[model samples]
Target: MRTVPKSYYKHFSNSEQIDFQKQSSLITLPQPRAHPFVPKDHPFFVRTDLTAHEMGPPKTVRTISQEAFDEVVKENMEDLGMEPTEALQDAIQTLSLQGVDLSGIVKCVPGESSLKDNPLIQSLERLKQLDLNSKDKFSDEDLNEMMGLFDKLIELCGGNEGSVNAAVATKNGGVELVCSICYKMRCGSKRVLDSCLKTMALLVHDVQSTETFRTGGGPKLLVNILIDGNEDPEILNSGFAVVAASATGNEVVKESYMELKIDELILEILSRQRNDSIQSLYDAIRVLLTPDDDQVVASQVYGYARRFAKIGIARALVHSLHAGLSSPSLISASIALKAVAVNDEICKSVAENGGIDALLRCIDDSGLQGNKTVARICCSLLSKLAGSDSNKSAIIENGGMDKLIVVSARFSDDASVLQEVMSIITVLSLRSPENAARAMEAGSGDLAIQAMLKFPNAQQLQRSSCFMIRNLVARNPENSFCSVMVSRNLSDRQRRTTKSARMQPLMH
Candidate 1:
């Protein structure tokens, strides 16, 4: 007999119970299917037996206010009997180790005023507090103290954050203050004036500050400095540096300087044999002569260059390139020469004034001394001078091709110098098959191949080398065979090292 559960009978009515009994006797149920097996470590497997209490409590985060932190520092100083600075440092270290953000925290000792909080501001305030009645009334000690303060300000303004410091200083009237100081001490001592000029140079780096300086008679003041301190190299260097720094990219400022006859003044300085201020003097001239993208400014700059050339600046530039000058001075002079050589006549004049021989000697000397920068600049100047037909003949006649190849080999590791050298070769071999032959004979083809192989990543060097090879092989068939052979060797070397197919066209 089959028995029914009492709970099943409770769900049926009296009349439905009879029908369910008949149906239950005929009904048949299917078997249950088996479940798939899953490993306990599988991500989808859940532990149904675990409870929330077994997972432990959540982590509690604690935060402290600035006032509370200050109280802790006070306790460290009072209870532990530590120095105020020591106490502050210890509190900062302990909190920082615990992953606390300590930004916006003042990092100075306690009880110091906010003025003393920043050294730059403190220096500015000290300078402002000075009583500049007259230069005569100030003692030597007073002047020395003022110079020291200025030096401190210079140091502050010459850091990695110098631009920001300059902005802050300008906002606080630093430019006007320095100009006032300069006017008061213009006649006092050369050392003070030098420092003041240098300080002003660093301050007027931005356009706003430069405009302030320009509007506040900075150009006339610097011109006075140049005129009064012409015999003093330190004063002249600082003065010219200010001029260069102030006039960069500011056409209005440049016009103001030109109006004050700055070009004529610089020519007068360059006429002297003093090598002390050569860098700053050349830098100032380069900045003034350099034109912006505006056509009007460029035209004005062209006229300025012509005026400079007529005033004997070419001879002065050539005169400064003597062998006795240092590498830095030589580099500056070469750059200045490149800038002023704006025309064929100017270029020819440079060559006529012993420019070729002087440049070759510089390349040789600087290459031997391992001063690659001087060598590079000399090669670039040679390229610029090679624009003229007579200059090209002069450079070749003076063995410029051989000198360039020698520089190429010496500075094979330097992509910049090699680029300059190859460019000069390209310029010299523009139309003359004779110069092309001279270049190949001087081992320029081999140097070019080596440069292409050594600096595969230097796109400009690669382009320059290809141009050089093209020029070498374009007119002179004899050199073409040599270049093809060099290219084959480069191909063999390239096959061994890298599988890049880009060098194939360049090689051939």
Candidate 2:
């Protein structure tokens, strides 16, 4: 259960004047344009009363102790960030779920002053009558009903753990009830699209699913709410859930949101830091990957990874990969490393800003397993970055030689990993074969390169020896690698000739 700050419930529950929602769930204009209202709240409006339970048994109840109530109220006032009196109103409304609305219980006492006890409810019921007499004012009862739904949601998530699941079940099963309620507020008007939102707003704040609000099309309404802007924090928070839910869907789910330009919202979520941690970024990616739309995918990746990639974001991801290289806990570290790998741009940006050195440090410091794999990837990256002779030479001087050897020697288990190490070395050698011969002489021989060579190996790395030989030939034609092979064969021939000459003497 995500515990909301008390003020979140407090101020949100009470202080909203009846007029705040009074404007006739009415749409500003009608028909030629589609009604903007997203839910069918009332029978007259959208007819969506799915979440509204038929006033059933209090499926669960608990009389909140005074201290518990005090803590809740304190949290409301302090944590929820509302004034105490306003907080009290919020508390009464929230506590109504446990069948402990202070006013309701106090008034239950025989002969208690009806005036002081249950004043808010009594006032609302009375204001409703006055509106009947006073001609065409907002019916306060509507505001009261809205408040009732809000209270139910608070209790649903806030209630005892056993009951919490039941509330979630009801919400997931019959969420449209809120739409029906809003429809009633809209008064059957054709132009009343925005009016549908009052109903949606409740669901956004109230609904929690078996898995999450993101599953199903629940996020669509939340997206709808965000596009409207001018929403309260509660509304925006629900919108956050919508983005989060998008991660769980298939093509249909993604299709439903394509019309919404979900990319902008994603950008807003990421760049705005709504989901900031590594785990949060993981979820953000998970949702983004679900949408096959390239524009949306790129936009979200651009949204978070790009904005911070230039900053320290890449470092954190690389740090994990480096740390994981030596870590015994392969599962967790590998998972994190994969997340960092999601965006190739992560690697590019890291290179531009000295990510290689940072990565090298990780290899140097790694305790064991994490070290070799990390070194291998780093070598792989350096090779890719070495786009030209200059780049290859730059990496060679920037410690690629030593790093590649470490990677080649240590991460000998995976053929693919080894191939990458070879590829990096090949690129370096290609820049200057003298460098290749130096590497080959240092221990990584033709045999080592042969071990990694395969049809699946990256094609660029297949000829490290070729590049070195070519350079060696240029370095000294008389002692070129090919010529040297010829010289060694000539020496053996001479030895055989000497043996023949001695045999001829013996025969004579």
Candidate 3:
């Protein structure tokens, strides 16, 4: 009874194994569970159904509200006993350090006297508060206040802080406000209009403000001002200043002004003997005609330069170079002439208008007065004009070679002036062996030798002298002989100097 059979035990074991398999099939394994506290969109949450590369929720950007900024500034003002402006600046700096986005926040403090803390803001606020549409005429007080505000704006937008202040003024609608004020006062007050134009000149120095000026019809306003204020020297000066400032490096503004026939206006204005605005007018012309690195804009500017020549701007510039013109005006006119002499036709136009003779006279006078700057610019313009065969002939016929030789001798110590003189000689002797012979005879070879010997470290001057020598000797055998002799002498002197340097070390 105690001994059970092994087969009976084996059958029980098989039955138990089959029962265990059925139970395991009927039962389900528990599914993986996520933490209860973790949200579905949390970065830590992993879903098996989704790919691993799914992006997480977007980050929140830190920002400060106007009220929050103002409260902080107020706290700084009360607790730290800081001035309102100081406290405001400190608050901006602190929040900025914390990576707070301060865009759209009013930069000024709140209060009836809020703007009084900042003159720039105060000026802008006062200008915006003016009701130009409501009144056809402004009293002396209103005009005076407006003038003061404009002057303040001008002061703020000039000098080392010009870029920053101009940006701030543009952001505060200073450009549009001034343009509107100018429109209302264009036909009203000369004094106010002049101040407004001057202010606009500085305001448009900012890039965004220039765009605002152009889109807001500032160019048209400026042209009208020039036409109506043609008789007023102050208005013309300020208006031309605005043109110069706005047209600089801005092709669209230049095209806009050109479309309005500003060239004609400038020519007409230039015809007058208004000495005060001559510099500004020339500056405006220079800026308008000057080309940048952009090929499309440069081509358009070349067209404008041609148009200026057609409209007698070259003659006008030549006229400005008359004997009695101020040195400043003379220099400005020469610079403007260089900008206008863009091509052969315009260069010939400049030459045909006595540009050569005028420039020669300027060189003589600058030499007599020891004015190297004037001479340098005159030589530069002469070189530009000399690019054309016809103009080069005109220059040589006008005693240009003798004038340059005399200038070089006079300012031999001035490497800058000599470089310019050498440049002109280089251009004059470009392809003409006859001109090269003439330059050699006129002491140009000696000038180059002297320049190279004197300014050994003057890289540009040395290079220019080399070019001059090459041009002078490239076509003429006689000139080449003289240049070789000069080079031999220069080499001998350099050898002697080196010998002295080595001997000095030995002596020591």
Candidate 4:
């Protein structure tokens, strides 16, 4: 019972019209809406009278979240028949249009058939082929791919602390990778070179890989980058970070770094007007001073510290500590000073370089905020410097004792810090009778006695406490510490304390 328009069948013959009607009947059409108006772009389309300005201000665009962006990218990539790396690149561009900063997306990962054919290693090889000046240099996709490869390699080794075989890194052309990065650095591509430096930072994390990196002239290249890119904070920061990662607890790498005179370069950087480079530089210096349990390594670390002293590490540390009392640099510099102080000659050198004044300042400033770590390291460095009689005089002249005694009392409940405080008092007491008298005036004898009674089982504390008392009594009996000990009825055995001295009843 359908009625056709009069013009529809006018152009067709009878047989053709019947065939067309049959075909039209098989085709499905959308049901027409029951509306007073027509749909736009329909065969019978209509226009509205309203103008575009009748609407309010334009809609605010929302940012695309990373997950949603990744999904969209994945779909588009599949539709376009693109690979993972290419898809990532396209995704970066898409995200950029949405005003997202994709600089950090370059951290990358993956699997394999062969080493070269392995997706992660293959990504690294492909990244190397990229021109330094190419638009791809800043591509988030490339950064992600390279970093992703590093993550997978770390996984393959098990974790950051996991050992990657040098043979494996070599076979996979990691040596060449370092060389290529070095070449890019020399090419003066600051933007591209930053990405390269970050890669080197991630690669030299493992023990064997670090050795391979060192053998591949990685340290030299890093130093060169640091030296050449001296004004570039990003490059310098990354370079120092690489040094820290590569040298941490790696003795062979430490020796290699020492030979490069990296200590001198670090000192030079520290001596400059550099606020941004402080953290990285301190971190590098800390790792460089890592105390090794291996005798051979320990000696090498000691020797390197002497060189550090020669290059004015103490002065640099003092400057950094002065800049920020609560900063990590303060703690690191203090620790480095303590390590270097193990050598008596270095102790005198530090004192000559105003180390005592620096330590006193850090102690006083850090104590205001009750920063026990900084205070503890400061006290420890002071105690180590006080190993030399001349340094002890320097400490006293710099108002070191007042700060030490106050900090000792403030942190008395902390056994380790108290032990260091007492050790300094012990060394100071040995310097002269005036120091012994000053100790008594500061209640050094009472603090030592209280420490011995509180930490009866802490042999180091007990020994340091006993030594302080013995020095006080032996050096200045008229100073009242002698009568105080006599009244307490402390035994001769208790009075005579060395590091190896055994504990006995004090009231006998």
Candidate 5:
């Protein structure tokens, strides 16, 4: 105030001058572009100046979201004022580019189709133009598009019959070709294959149950279109996969094995003996093992096992038994052996064809991964065949008791395998205590005690082992060493050793 100091006035004037200049200036900034990848909204929005020295042209490789794809597809259908099929196809192509997820559209059930009723599917069918074998014949583009459409229909198919015809309609036959190809590939797809499998089981069932198919001409209709009459193993093998998965646990599918014709198919499929054939043979055995409706199927099972025992088929089974020594086809090989073991006729064929020796050979092989399983089954067969004194004597004479005792030590830690083996021994002991005595002499108590200690929790195996222990002690009080050996097995859990880069680690 005192007419502020002149120096103060000079500082204040300088600050006021700066504020005046800021208020007078106008700011200009660049505008934002609509495209996230591009910088500006113009056609060449990426470039700040259109006439600036150019580099390469702008690149856009944006992958849209699934929601965006469905919207685009729906909008295209709506806009297809005159040409709906072309519009729908265009939308499908466009959406395919956008990466829509299509995992579950094959059928509502095994053999059924839900395409006719779904709104999206209805829209797609409105765009349908079935011209098989033509340029339009289910073009790869259409196939890709139509396959997603299958995700909406996983219910109707039991697997083989019904609306499979509608899924790939074709006038030129190319569509049908691609259609079957799609199904073949789909057989491996997890989402809709359950439906596909159901349909296949129904197909096998329909064939065996129908007098027309088994006795008349039903196989002709099915095998021609389905089994391929020896052509296109993809079609044949795929059908077999469905049959395998379906018939594995489902009884309705198993009865289909009764027909003498399924045997022919099984033999034909096995004739190849390739991995695919191995897979099919496994499936055919499954179909036989779990037959649902027909009691007569057992006779067919015996017949097939016998036929195989007499020729290349029996050799194949033995080879499988040998392989099972490595990484046996557990379920399939089990059924194969069971096919021979369960039926009297098959057992006769096996013995007549020297199967016991084959089993013994498998037993003798050293360093087998699943040999214990094979041994258990072999022992079971021996127990069954030993209905007479001669049978028991033959088993002991072949060193059966000794061989089983040695093999038992290898899988003592694997409770399930141990249980199986001990179950076999229990049967032998019950049928002939003298054989049990021989088994104890062959060191059965030692193997069983170790397994019991290792797998004390396996009730079934424990029960069987308890019985075997009594049998062993009864054979000789000197075998108290077996109880000691089993007691030693109980406390030790297999330890995971330190892993080095060079060593292959053992895993549980």
Candidate 6:
């Protein structure tokens, strides 16, 4: 090659020099040798050139393809004997720390136990264990962070009943964490307490946890929060929700209302007269005064029922009934008002507050008849209210008899509603000639007799219907109700009454 320059030969190995000369068009330098063990065009070394502005930046770790990354993660997880879920969680935590793109990774849906073990929840657990005695030992930022973590945990759990119970179990005793939070809430700044109360409301979801809250003195803690934080609607509403949740199904918790003075708190919320608080106040009142299956709690509820009326809860409920007659809360309120109307004085109060008209409207609501609970509750309250002559006249004057007859026929298939409607009509017909006249005028006597024939097997309905028909006949002997009963042989004792001892009360 005309004795190729040594400068060209300097860069080439002897093996590369022969091949370079054979492949070249002119006398060319040999290409630099690449190791045979490594690929000549591998990207790892191919794109290594850096521009001037990037010279100071540290080299990044090699980015792996997503398939390789997943395979590596799966292998590591398998090697460690970890569940795929845990591996994903670990990956998410790690990638989040490194600020990596997570677009393709599957997110974790934590279970009850997994949620309890979350880092944020663990931090809250530690915060709850902190020595309140230490006072200023913890900075305000630390406390705020603790409460904020609890809020985050609650939001993450999303009020799932299982997650709620799991969180409660993680704290010791059902409500230790809730009680601790409420205690902190009472003293926290408005914003802090409001957030804390929100967490409390979420935690008090089920009956067991709610009872634990009541026994743990959660109600007392919340009452103080409401009393002091009434100006803050968030705190007020959240605190009320917690109390309502706690008292919802647990009669024992309801019994604590008087001791906690929750009635006054409800009235306080009501006294603000804010429309937002109306539902909260009604919920609290309903839980406090609604009868439970437990007789002791029912008696206590009965005793406190009049107190709610005296404090204008009865009137507010009636007003709410008029405002949202089709609302479920009003349905609940009407049932609660039944408990209140058990007290004769409170029944009079219900009428005085325009409750009779409202109640009749509720009974007459075409949409309300489908909800058996609403129909039965409305009828029960009307029956109790109709015990008084004034309320009886008010009911009749407000088309009460017509409403009862319509509900009876509409829900004729519902034994409970039919029985209640027949009972109220019975109460109106008993020893009241004008009510009897109105019942006849409105064709309630025919409905009652129809209910009798329709539900001959429902002993309560049969007894109520018979009593109502007999009263209709006694009030107006010439009325066709007597002729109908006689015609159907419903007047026969064997067919009209049941032999069950449970039906004896109705027989009398």
lDDT of 4 by residue, 311-366 (tens): 78866676665555745567766776675555777787776666777778878876
Count backbone clashes in candidate 4. 9
Superposed model 2: Cα runs more than 4 Å off? 1-277, 280-349, 366-384, 387-394, 429-438, 446-508
- Per-residue accuracy of model 3 over 1-508 as CA lDDT, tens digit each: 0111122122124654344334323322223244344222222122234222222232223444445666777765665565677667766764453235565355775453453566777788878777443365677778888888888878887868776677667766778888888888877889989889988888887455678999999999999988998888888889999999988777889999999999989888877755544468888988898774253423488889889988788888887777523545888888898998888888887777777888888898888889988999988998898889887788888788998999888898899999999898888888787888899899887776677778888888877776677677666767656556465657564334322211211100
For model 6, residues 26-77, the per-residue Cα lDDT tens digits are 3222232374433333211212233434333332222223344455345435
- lDDT-sorted candidate list, best first: 3, 1, 4, 6, 5, 2
What lDDT score is found at residue 199 in candidate 4? 58
Cα-based TM-score, every candidate: 0.72, 0.35, 0.74, 0.61, 0.49, 0.61
On lDDT, the candidate that comes out on top is 3
lDDT of 1 at 261: 87
How far is each candidate from the true structure, as Cα RMSD in Å?
20.1, 23.4, 18.8, 21.4, 21.6, 21.9
User: Pairing residues by index, what is the TM-score of model 3?
Assistant: 0.74
Overall lDDT per candidate, in order of appearance? 0.73, 0.41, 0.73, 0.62, 0.45, 0.61
Better of 1 and 2 by lDDT: 1
Write one digit per residue (lDDT tens) for candidate 5, span 144-221: 544454433323333343334323221112222323433443323332333333333333323222332233332333
Candidates 1 and 4 compared by lDDT, better number: 1
| Best-matching candidate per TM-score | 3
Off by over 4 Å in 6: 1-174, 187-195, 198-216, 247-256, 276-278, 290-299, 324-329, 365-377, 407-417, 449-467, 470-476, 479-508
Residue range 272-324, candidate 1, lDDT tens digits: 74654447888888887888525252436777777788888977888878753
- Model 3: which residue pairs collide? none
**Candidate 1: segments with Cα more than 4 A from true spot:** 1-116, 131-142, 275-278, 292-299, 324-328, 490-508
